[model samples]
Target: MKFKAQLHNNTVLYRIAQSLAKLGKTAVVQLSQEFIKFIYLGESEASFQLFAPIYMKNIFVDYNIQSAHDNTIYMEFQVDNLIKVLKSAQGNETIAVRLLRKQKKPYLTFKISGYSRSGRTVLIVQDIPVRVLTPVQMSHIREPVVPQAQVNILLPPINNLRSVAERIKSVGQCITISASNTGKIKFHVASEIVDIEVFYRDLINPILPNTKEFESDQIYQNHLERYFSCTISTKNFVKFLYAHYIVPASISCVLIENHAIIFTVYVTTTAIGAHFEDQGNACGALTYYIPAFAL
Candidate 1:
């Protein structure tokens, strides 16, 4: 998202209207008020005020604005070609000098009509400050944070076992062991394997502990041990899942007002024949609740 800052022109216009309404029958106010009627194409009188430095007194007295719509006011004035001089003034300073110098800028006009003890009053107008959009800017955004931990698991020999090994190599850590009855196959990834290593070394675990490939005694569980660690960065981890067929699960919840929840959990597809009542299978979601030990 982006942000833009500009003057609340509508509020400034309202102030101008209020100032004119206080002018009563003053000739200067009356003339500006009269000019406003023609510009606004309406008959309405409103009070307005214009405050500026003493040096700018004449500017406010002679300057005028007309309403273009329910929320817009405009002015017309001329300025020298020096944009630097024009950009220095802020808010009132900008409007004051622009009007007094008759800089080539826009003006505001308002429609006004009223009747006082003296007689009819019309075109009550005043000049107010405003701003416009100039340039666009861009900024960088920070990514989200992710907590991490380590887990060791026995992997199954899927079709893309080699691909999985390569992924683990990128992380620089991981250990996988595939056991079967026909023979025993052990695997260990000492470090993350990158594309360059494919030329010097095999991507797959060429040796498992003592076995070169598959051994019948080691297939079921002949004590084939391997150690590997993976340093998973958040970005790479997310990309890995994106490349693989394995999609993470998702859960969504909506809650209103106060609510409470206790333990909750999930069991993976490869989980041993476990019961849902086990602590490892329970997790919790709550709208609001205090911890049991908080007291």
Candidate 2:
């Protein structure tokens, strides 16, 4: 079995590793002919699973995969170790990865080459013991329903969000995100000593699939105009906010009352606009889900 590939964008590859490392110490990487997937599950039940998929043709300049026994290859490694090697790569460097078996053990060799110098690092494959909750089981476990109140809002600049979140996170255990169809959103944190609310107005509210249905119903229409609030762990939400630096494209937030809020960062190698439906080929995405809490 032999697998080798070369990626053109070292920054994007490093960002992918950084996103996975934010969730857990280890990451499960599954490579196929079409795409590469990185999966990471947090240590806590309330923590969300980080799923990043990068299309082969979109990210890689040269690729080859040949398995003697299987069509797909799966391996696990320390995210920090992989990240350490990836950090050594300069912005202009090309990343080369090779998977080979030695003495019945699998190993991954990573090489970073630039115009002047190059470095190589080899890591032994390790097994990830963590088991992530599947989407089916997650729905069952959470008993999530179609949110009575939902908001699809365009996110503000990542640096602004990160700065506010960092300040507010120190004051509260959780942050409350409130949104309305009036194009207003608020991030609030309240504790025994201080209460702070950061407001952003005139934001675009993207039309969701059920927007028409909600518009026709008087009850849903009324609910849409009213502020819908969801609380999530401040620490976890801050981690999600930090991923903005890794994603060069636009980011969007979808909030579902008493259910889950998802932060999706559009990733693509092409110049095409960001669309939620785009997947694989020239486009891929990374999504971070934060479960809502009722207090």
Choose the strongest candidate by lDDT. Answer: 2
Backbone atom clashes (below 3 Å) for every candidate: 55, 0
- Give per-residue CA lDDT, model 2, range 107-146, as digits (tens): 6766655554345533222221223223344332331234
Off by over 4 Å in 1: 1-102, 135-295
How far residue 234's Cα lies from its native spot in candidate 1, in Å, is 38
Top of the candidates by TM-score: 2
Clashing pairs for predicted structure model 2, backbone only: none
lDDT against the true structure, each candidate: 0.24, 0.68
Give me candidate 1's TM-score against the actual structure.
0.15
